[model samples]
Target: PQVVSARFECPSCGNIINVSQDDTSFKQPTKCGCGRKGKFRLIEKKLIDAQKLVIEEAHELLEGGAQPKKINVYLHTDLTSPLTEKRTNPGTKVLITGIIKELPIMTRSGSQSVLYDLSIVGNYIEPIEEDFTELSIEPQELKEILDLSKDPKLYEKLQLSIAPSIFGHERVKEALVLQIFGGVRKKRDDGVITRGDIHILLIGDPGSGKSQLIKRMSVVAPKARFVSGKGVTGAGITATVVRDEFTQGWALEAGALVLANRGYCMIDELDKMNKEDRDAMHEGLEQQSISISKANIQATLRCETTVLSAANPKFGRFDPYMPISDQIDLPVSLINRFDLIFAIKDLPDKERDKVMSRFILKLHQNVDSSKEVPIETGLIRKYVAYAKQKCFPVLTDEAISEIQNYYVKMRSTGVEEESKSVPISARQLEGILRLAEASARIRLAKTVTVEDARKAIDLMQYWLSELAMDKETGKIDIDKIASGITTSERQKIVGVREIIIELENKLGKVIPTDDIIKEAETRGISATKVEDSIEKLKRSGDIFEPKPGFISRL
Candidate 1:
């Protein structure tokens, strides 16, 4: 409803009058100057399509489990167009100028009640990127942040500041700090772009401080969103497509990831999410964008947000000898998208258990005392926001040399090119570079130094040692995490298949399980491994069981 001038003619004395429709409701001149009391003849009129929407508060603003507040707004005329409607996307912020009015509410008896509802007749609206709140830092605060960064133990202090009550996992805390101050996004002359946001996953035992870290992070970061996998859908994490009856088209609605654009998002209990819901996040995590095409509505929303997710093991506990991928139900493709994956284990140690118990008791007795951190949570939040907004570190020659040396040396560890168990790939190299840049930004430095590169490499090596090690070969293998199948597993499968073929040639199309196990054991493979390999081949349709004790290759 754009403001249009409408003219009405009076039948009495043939008088002409003009009236403007500037208000939400149309109004005609009650009585023309000619003293006419009847309906006036309409000589001109203009109508436009419009729609109403209700916007709710963002997830970062809520404290714990509070319900979000909502407000109603109306879009007029051209504002209802597809392009314009995308600006004021739900889940993001918006600044609007409008006139508020109260409308009567209907009671059970179908009559207007005394109470009324409030709505705004919007005249203008624009998109706004929210950073938790309108956090404005003064000049004095900026100086304090700079001085804090210059401390010799700056890294340790920052790590201790996050989740102070947690006993261990200093490396995980350091990684989270780096995640807050991400790397610089690069755009080349050819229009190709590289994502700077980092994604990390933590899978561990049940009571191993995973959820506690996530909750503390929600308070430590100025613009952090917290979500759980339970009760979440594909549309809830990415974007939802709704059928609009008024426009007879589909409308796009932003979800958790989009709402946290340029910020941090923590997802707890990640393993509990449905397969479809988890698949929807593959594009958002890598490309930094969310695309939805449903009912003829196709669009892409920018989601340059960093993710830190946590999950528990499928069997309720973690085993040191088991492969990380085998213990979790996530797909290999999704696993490869994460820049860093940490495995947190809870083991039994008398001394460590005693100290942890004492810490927990003290926390339960007087929580305030256990909350002591090197820096206050609020100032740390402001410091993170300032570093992300003002600092962008570029790689220096020494830093590049450090990264290159590490990659060249690591890649050379494999045996041969053809079926080599690559220890690392370009994906890991990019992750290390991003981490190095972020480490420099933590100190507000203009260029990444050699020290930053080494620190990032050390952290990456730590994670790899725990999750990416091939237990059978006693060597690091990237395929373990990247493809969920290691060189050792592949070798076992091949050996079992070859043994079956040789047995068929001698035993006439029938292979006995006892003979296969004996041959495998002679080749240094255990009976259990041989049985597992045979089961794997059977499931893959490479072989089948002809009788209870025999298996034949198909």
Candidate 2:
């Protein structure tokens, strides 16, 4: 396949001639013009660069439940360079200028069949633009975008335009708006990179419009893939290696995250994913790459994808009394990766219920009663694209100080004498910075001011108060939402363990369950709390039930 030039010597006349092979196969000159029509002596052959590539349709381009199609492409000479090869890698959307030719198919009986397979002999290839940064805007549209950015209530207007049909969730809508207009990703001089993408998770009760919200987000994003957690696999979400039917060799296939690079991936029913499959997202979420090392095929594929996911609680409805980590089936490590986690509860409120009922009734009656979108969808999309393409905001001194002071103040809230629980960490600080950048981008500002910093802090404070703060201690304990265990619960478990130790010393090796519960109650731990702690300890192998109604520490 790489043969570029062939030289042959005529046996009769001893004439040396060179021929260039440009077609799919090597060709020999028919005559040497020496009057001798016999076989020529083989001289020399030169070979150049060549490679085989597999091209497939992108997952995002598929519609109406259609599957992606694939074909083999032949690359030669200039097309086989490193830069061109990288641009044509799997999962990347590319435009190829090539010749479509047919290759003879081999039948099962080992004969060449008349039927042929189509393949592309690529002469030129280029990757398609996958991010809004490459969006093209007209001069008139640019003027309109700049004018819209100057509006005093631009943020509020964008939030209102997100999903007009969904009632309430103003805060969630605001977060989604910021997510759509992402922050500026930066790389430090030391080569460390920080992501600007905001990952949002909606954990709500059944019939709370979570799926509808996800669908709306997918529709609004410039490039997005809508998938359900139940239907997705580890290979489906990341990268996998498959046997190529045409090549009869292993070929790497890009998954959802890789296919949606520089875009958004909306995953509904997030909690329905299996543990092993969910674990595969760890690298893609944090590192923005998926490393596949299966079937002797090892490669890391880029996946700079922002995830917007929705999930239902384990018990079919959210439990307001329990920590969010306890109510969901997802691992605490995985839950912590989300920048913002919102709980959408369906509570019983007389006036709110009446309004919701009326809204649904109006929809059923074919009457338009919903509030009009503050900004049209097309205009907003262009506005967002314009901002993302042209605006890259940097933090001002005042903004940096604001974020720093808030982080210091929140972390210092723990009691000085006790084992201080971390109220907020550097991760949240990074989140705050990203949100502030997004806020500034919304206004098309190149500098993040104190006002933008304040907005970010307010949103962060609201999320912390609702999801991270412990009501009993009146302090924020990240462990409550991050580890599925609160400081108060940890203290109760420690108290129960202490009671068991005391009883074991006072009584024999076996301590009665009633005595342990009575001692824990005296120490201000409720009987039910003590019993729950005991069961947890037993399951963790810290203690064991020696006999009925009796326990012994390991």
Candidate 3:
């Protein structure tokens, strides 16, 4: 397969013959003109570039009880290098134009058998789907999209169109719409890059339509992949190195994130994922790339993919009074990476429930449901695609001033109160900028205005109020969401630690747990709160149990 050209010289007449091998296998010239049939003297030979690729059916494409099929493809010459090497990597969907050829099978005795294995000799290879810029839009459709962007209520209309069949998640739907348009990615002169994609997490009760919303988003997004957390592995979500039977060596296989590059990936049942598997997403979310080093293969795969994930609370239902970090099983580090988190509770409100019930019943009874959706699904997709491809808005002076004022005001609250809790961080500020840019993109605006900044701030405030507000302080404490500990809980832990130290100093080395709790009570901490804090400190190795009901500082 590698031989490009071969030279042959006849033994009888010294006539030289030059032949080029173009077929799958080596080809010999039919005639030498002198008619010498014996083995000729081999003089010169040249080899060309060649490679093998394996294509397998994606897991999502498989039906129940069905196994994915795999095929081997052979690539030679120009197709082996340059473009195909990047686009036709493992796990990426590709449309290959090739000629199917049969390879003779060999028996155990090394003799050619009657049976043959089929393989494709690829002539051309291209991705199955292109990016949004490559979308084919008619002139009339382009005009309609531009017109839709000009509508006064375009934002509200798009929000209603998202998951129209699902009722009572206007905020979540609005966030999803912003995520589809996204923002403009920027690379500074110093080489720092800021990602434009938004990540959202939905923690809700069962039967709250989280899955349905995710499915709807995948449909609206130009390129998207749906994956379940329980079914995905660290390697499956990131990248892996596996043995390639065709090449008899390790080959790098791209994962879901890489496959969905420059698109969206929806992960459902997020809480069900193992710790190690969830940790694999850390770099992908923050750095927009996945790095793999295993089996002598090391590489970083691009994964500029937006993530929309859904998870159920630890107890199968959300607890409104509890901090969001405490309700979900995900680590604070991973949770904080998401730009927005919404709790879709299934609380009972008679009037709202009545309205939702009527809406669903009317839809089931074949009433006119089209009135609920302002925009059709096809047009919505095209509009979003056009916006993302064409719009790249920059922040205006008014927008910058608005965002800066909000950040400074929020930071001042924590400082003025002398609260150990952080009201906001640079990460949240970046999220605000990204959201403002997305808002401008929705209007097809070249500059993010004060109005866009205000919209972004309103959404951020809504999320913070729902998920990050401290019940005791009545103030936003970002640490409650970024770290698992609230300010009150942290203070209680500090009090318990001090009580333990005081007792140990007064009553020799080991102190009774009951004495520490009794002392903490005098310091205004309840016995139950003292015990809870003591247990946490012990778990974190700040203190250790010498014996039953006895504690000592570590």
Candidate 4:
């Protein structure tokens, strides 16, 4: 075999270096020794004199058994000019048809060389297009896809294919799978489409797979885009000002939402998104369109994209007592935009620990993945494709009734105490239906069953209870924190607050916190409970400390 030397540029670092190769083929690691890896690919190559081929023509030549001897091409075009106002080089996809005349060789003192040179005889440039296909499907077909009870192994396989290397958070994985296949359109009482997409918010601590989950969905979903909230401006998300091609003046360019159109957009570090970006998302979340008149270009861009977003708690970890609005550091407007919010707190548990350990071990070592592969990754794609081609089924009476009851009970039409002020909104109800539909679609069920609705509700409830309900005050709350409270914590705080208030009225003068603690004990409240309640009241500003170790009613 003749030895040939080639340069391998690290995709991450863009460092060009040389490697020796025999004509024999081999698998190479997708990493460079400089601790950079996984986010790069072979971008460009040059060839000469034998033939100049673009990707389409190259494939055609391969089919026709015409193998050119040597080919050289240059990648020198500025890509991403169509999207960004600054004309950033996102990347390029090109096709060429020409003849190669010469080749470049290496003259080295241990130096790397560029491969292949070509003399262009003739060439053709094909327009590069973005893939924007969203899977379509009927309701009956979706139902059949989700009815996986008859084949447990198939269900497991599907999960494996979708999740692949995902570890822990089985609940999150299941929720995401449902969201992918679920239809996001809603028929209102007045017969108009209100909301047509599923909006999910994942609030978690650092390293909780929030970003990983979003990335995974981007790959599994038929059409998806992953963006970072920190990097995305308001114009980057909904629509923004750009220079017009025809008039050579500024115009509005559609953001990821408009570009994604009928697919999914996974946003990472959503809490880090600017306030203006948060404001822009509100309308798109409900109206599914962004209306703007920037640089004299008035337009409403379609943003009918299912949003899967991840955020960190404001305080870094969840504290059960604070209002969610306080804990998350996100505006109520943006928080309410999501149909469902999940708290991915890193709770320490034995089974979870074991699973995590295994997951890490598998990644650190090249263990046998043959037996671990559950479903054909390709099959999952086919299933999603099939569902997209089918029509969506309407909700049955049982499913509708279950959803209606849930909305009526948890969400009040009128405001009550701090505890009751419409826990779930009408938009959330629609989200529930979509999630149920998605679940059914995954199972290949013809129609969404009552069981599917309950499953969705169960998961939603778990999330709401932790993220929305405040255990210290028994109030519906949101916060920048990651963990919530047990019901008992609420009762304890309320009880202690009551005792402190009674002591203030009975004694007339300010009572020391210890005296209030004694009074609480006489009223059957433990010292711990008294302290907990005092802290809650203090946090809420219901009581104040006029002196050290003393309490005053606010």
Candidate 3: give the clashing pairs: none
TM-score of 1: 0.85
Candidate 2 residue lDDT tens string, 482-539: 7777777788888898888888789978988999888877778888989899998998
Q: How much lDDT does each candidate structure score?
A: 0.84, 0.85, 0.86, 0.65
lDDT (10s digit) by residue, model 1, range 1-554: 45467788888877777887865456887897867787989888776776788877765689898999877777778778887776665555678789998867768897779998888878887766547334578899888998998998988888888778888888899998888777888889998879888899998899999989988887787667789999688899999988763355788877889877877888998889999999999999998899888888889998988898999987878876667657876788988999999888899999999998998888789879755778888788888878878888989999999999998888888665444788888999999999999999989999999999998899889888778888776778999999878887888889889988888888888888999999889998899999999988998899999899888889
Model 3: per-residue Cα lDDT over 1-554, one tens digit each: 38888998887888889998765456666667887676778888898888888787867789999989977888889897776686665445788899999888878897889999888999988786655765678999999998998899999888888888888898898889899988788889998889999999999999999999999899888878899999999889888898886567898877888888888999999999999999999999999999888988888889999999999999999777766557887899999999999998999899999999997887788756745578888888788788888899988888999999999999888778745678888999999999999999999999999999998999898998878888778888888888877777798898788777778779988899889877887888998898899889989999888899998888
- Full ranking by lDDT: 3, 2, 1, 4
lDDT of 3: 0.86
lDDT: which candidate is best?
3
- Segments in model 3 whose C-alpha atoms lie over 4 Å from true places: 8-42, 56-63, 78-94, 106-114, 124-128, 367-372
Model 2, TM vs. native: 0.87
Worst 10 residues of 1 by lDDT: 126-135
Cα error, candidate 1, residue 165 (Å): 2.5
Residue lDDT tens for model 4, 1-554: 12244556686567875555422232334667788856444433332222112222323246556764443342222321233212111112344444555544444674435774444434444434223233344586445555533575654556666766667677777777777765647667986776646688888878877887788778777657788988899878887786643245775556877767677888898888888887888888778888987666778877777888899888888775555435777777677777677778776789878988887787768645623675554446557667655546567889888878877777652245543333565556676777778767655567778987887788777777766665445555333222233334565677777776677788865878888777777877788877877777888898888889987887
Error of 3 at 477 (Å): 1.0
Better of 1 and 3 by TM-score: 3
